[model samples]
Target chain A: MRTDLCDLLGIDHPIVGFSPSEHVVAAISRAGGLGVLGAVRFNDAAELDTVLTWLDRETGGRPYGVDVVMPSTVPTEGLPEDLNAMVPSGHHEFVERTLLRLGVPPLSAAQDRPGVLGWLHSVARAHVEVALNHPIRLIANALGPPPPDVISQAHDRGVLVAALAGRADHARSHVRSGVDIVVAQGYEAGGHTGEIAGMVLVPEVVDAVHVPVLAAGGIGSGRQIAAALALGARGVWMGSLWLGTTEYQSGHALREALLRATSSDTVRSRIYSGKPARLLRNRWTDAWSAQGAPAVLPMPLQNLLVSAAHDRLMASGDPTVVPMPVGQIVGRMNEVRPVAAVLSDLVTEADETLGRLHKLL
Target chain B: MRTDLCDLLGIDHPIVGFSPSEHVVAAISRAGGLGVLGAVRFNDAAELDTVLTWLDRETGGRPYGVDVVMPSTVPTEGLPEDLNAMVPSGHHEFVERTLLRLGVPPLSAAQDRPGVLGWLHSVARAHVEVALNHPIRLIANALGPPPPDVISQAHDRGVLVAALAGRADHARSHVRSGVDIVVAQGYEAGGHTGEIAGMVLVPEVVDAVHVPVLAAGGIGSGRQIAAALALGARGVWMGSLWLGTTEYQSGHALREALLRATSSDTVRSRIYSGKPARLLRNRWTDAWSAQGAPAVLPMPLQNLLVSAAHDRLMASGDPTVVPMPVGQIVGRMNEVRPVAAVLSDLVTEADETLGRLHKLL
Candidate 1:
């Protein structure tokens, strides 16, 4: 099952898991696959330093990576006094009214808010600097191409740089900007995405760029992994599949909703983060897309607008209104297994699928 | 390279080409594939009968299929005196205004108008009856599942029945209704399509149904065909790839436009067919989706509203205003080739791709 990607990343397998959990990162790397920790949630550099130190000790010196949300552009001026001020009044009213209609209680003032930093370029650079200090094998930009200096910095440190692209032209631009790898994310992916699907986007990106491509979105099983390889991608970058792992930090209510949901239960809406991200459709998404709903704002403003509301919704523990970023592959994630078990199953299934095809030849 | 689909369809390869041209249909079948004639353009049973007879003679006893746009449900009681009467005034004005702005001239009164059928159940049934009279190996419905009686009728005549679906649940419904094959058409596909991409939709449909599954949408090369098989699809069903074939009846201007257009040049809009179809972005599509554009009408009405205008635009010999249904794969189609040459290239490329993967094993 080893491909050029395994040789490049110095991993036994080509499957790369992206998650925000340190436990998942260590487990996936120890299981012979690459685990990329999403560092977008850390607002404090000291806190990120602490997390990376813990991850370093937990991985037992195995290779792992860090992913930051460094979008190519951000609003530079007109900084608001408070993040909440950036949100429109209509959007706030819509969220509050919908929660009220859904019979959800307000959160206590003492509840901790969700972290928000990666959307800003300055904060993301801090994260990149912290990540580079550690023995990180790779650094990935979640939103777009990393700045030229950041790519050069990673290169200078002998670390590979990867960027997520939803379109072929984006992949070409990333390659032109000196990215070592391109993750072709389809519309069915959990996070920010473009309109193209993985099946079409993978080959297009692979053809458009000279760099190795990693196929993402709606990839859960060995058959899907094989499909990605067949489409000319060197590896598969998975995020949603790891959400159902026992090591993830998902609450019981969220896990239950994910297990019970079908592929059709997800929708690509701008309600969660300014961009169109595939999320589990719940009362919140429905309310935002419903008639008379206000248009969603873009980028940092949208992230800031929903940060407090997301914290409150999570605190409320009302499953119907909680937001969960997941892909259509959630349909196949019917159980919570250990990370090791998930990796073993993927390898075995892929082997059997390849064996079946060999019989055809 | 042979799979269960080849045995079921009794073809040399699992590739199936769908087009409205008899010349292309016969050429594909002769080149060791199943050629499905798009019968939606045939309003008169006599015309379809003549075409089928010619195809039969051309293929020299090889198996072929017929495709009709017979949506399972339709408004039967509200039959209009003429097709134009069913179209709303606003939609007609929008089309006329857009064409005038593009400097397109009206067609002569004596010019023959394009046939508008299949959107109506009555006309589609006539198409099915005429098709069954010939030695059609398969009968496929382009929209929705064929009615239970229609399936039984095809079964009684020993002709297999297939239907196109964009969602997993829709595939299950088609299987429940006795479809022998399910064509999973993704959002990147030409003609009427659902929101899901072929990569995600194929595996989902393959898991949901017991019948053979054909992957469609954005498939133009052998690598894509291999990807479909890896995703658990039995074969590949193609539509847009045949549009630029020398055997097709497309005008030189239209073929030139298709050759020059990129994947990003297509848009999914509900202007031409009432259903969201991925078409080459042109002056007509841009006008319809432009700001202050009127809302598109329902299925048959939308088709009727654009029918005469479509004829005039094609007659005008101005490709910019003409609406052409194509997939994102159009970006790869930079040249026109004979249908036989295209099919031969696909087989050779697929063989090479499979051999390369075997070496990896």
Candidate 2:
């Protein structure tokens, strides 16, 4: 199941595991696939620097990457309190009403106030700076192409730059911006996504861009990975499949909720982070979509308005009320397994699938 | 490349070309793939019978099939005028306003009144009966499992019964209802579809069903066909790819519009039919979704109310006003070609893709 992406990314296999947990990222790197830690939740530059420093020693020097969320057009930046003030009171009221309706309790005084200033350009730039300081082999931008300076900085350090694109044109633009790889993330992906599905987008992006492309979205099994490679992707970028891994830092109840979910259990809604993201259909999403609910504010404001409520819901340990971003592949994640076991099973099944397909021709 | 489905369906290749045009159907069959002619557009039994007879001679003894749209629960059957009377006046007014806003002229007196009586259970039953009288090898129900009696009737005549499913449970239900094949149609499909995308739906359906599974939705190229087979589908069922074929009975301007469209130009909306359907985003779909527009009616009534306006829009020869049911694959339909050429190209490319993946193992 080896492809050029394996050599390009300095990984044993052409699989890239994306997770927000530093533990999962280190585990994936140790398991032969490249582990990419999502740095969007790291609001403070020092916090990200501390984590990357930990990750540098955790994987025993295996290749790993950091993913930052930076939109093409820079967004407004401010302190958490200032961003909260900008959110419309009606939207805030709706969130409050929804939390109450969902039976989520208020956070305790000991808990820190939740913030989403990471969505701001300043924070993302800081994340990139922190990531570059570590021994990272790759740097990825989740929303769009990283700024030109970031790309140049990564290249100067001999690190590969990758970006997630939902359309062929987006992939082309990323290539034009000097991205080394394009991850064609489709509509069925966990977080923010576009309308095109991976079955259509992967090949289109492959055809559009000159660089290698990794297929993402609705990819849980080895057969789907084989299918993605068959569609001309150099490898597969999988995120949602890692959520149920033992190393992922999610609540046990939320993990149980994800395990019980079917493919149809997810819906693409803007209630999560004020951008269209595929989330588990729960009270949080349903309440915001009700008839009287106010329109979700955009980006940083929406996340700032709902972050505290999200924290409370998670702290409540009520799976149905907790907001979870997941892909349609949630149906296939029926159990929690160690990262090494999951990667081993995926490689074994992918090789078997590829062998089976070879017989067809 | 052959699978067990080729032997079961008695086709040279594991591709099923789905189209309403009998001409395209015969060409696909003659080109060594199974062609399933859509009977939902045939309002008269005699008209369908005539087309089946023509297809019988046109294919020169090649295997072909018929596709009918029958809701799981039968709807009220009535004459065109009777059904039109059942439509709510508000919906009727919306359609009228939409046509006017799009500058679509009324159909001439010489043109026949458009009726969607074919959507009725009685008409669909008639289509099945007429198709049984021909040499069709398969019968596919597009909406849900054909009623138990319909399945039995097809089985009694040695005709295979197939059903389209968007979820694994639906596929299991179809298998329980005695379907010989299941077409796992995804959200990116051209016509009425469910929320699951093909990349996730195909393998899930394949695992759930005991019978052969054919992958559908966002399937335009040979590479997509290879991807489908790699995902464990026995074959591929493609509909949108035929829209630009030379044999398809569509206006040149409409074809041009499709050629000019990218994958992003289509939207899944219920404005086309009572059920959710993916259609080309144009003035027609936009007007129906604009603020103050009445809610789209369900099923037969919705089609009845919009039938006249649809006819008028088609007659206007304006690409933006014509409602075309197409998938995201519209981006790849840049030119008109013969069905044989399309099939040949798909086969050639699929074999090439499969061969490439084989080396990876």
Among these predictions, the greatest lDDT belongs to: 2
For model 1 the interface RMSD, in Å, equals: 1.6
Specify the highest-DockQ model's number: 2
The sequence of per-residue lDDT tens digits that candidate 2 reaches over residues A17-88 is 999899999999999999999998887889999999899999998999999999898777777778778988
Candidate 1, which segments miss by more than 4 Å at Cα?
A77-84, B77-83, B112-115
- Pick out the ten consecutive residues of candidate 1 chain B with the lowest summed lDDT: B75-84
Estimate the TM-score of every prediction: 0.97, 0.99
| Predicted candidate 1 versus true structure: per-residue lDDT over A1-361, tens digit per residue | 7789999999988999999998999999999999999998888878999999999999998899999987788654234346567777888788778778877777676777554756767778889999999999999998877889999999999999999999999999989999999999987888788887787789899999999999999888888887788788998999999989999977777887888888778888887778788898888789888899888988777877777777777767767767888888888889999999999988877666666655555
What tens-digit string does per-residue lDDT give for candidate 1 at B1-361?
7788998888998899999899999999998899999987887889999999999899998899999887777753245357567667776777778888989887776887664765777878889889999999999998878888889989999999999999898899988999999999987898888877776788889999899999999888887887788788888999999998999988866887898887778888887778888888998788887898888887777777777777777777776766788888888888899998998888776666665555545
What candidate 2 keeps of the native contacts, as a fraction, is 0.89
- What lDDT score is found at residue A7 in candidate 2? 88
Clashes of each: 0, 1
lDDT measured at residue B3 in model 2 versus the true structure, 0 to 100: 90
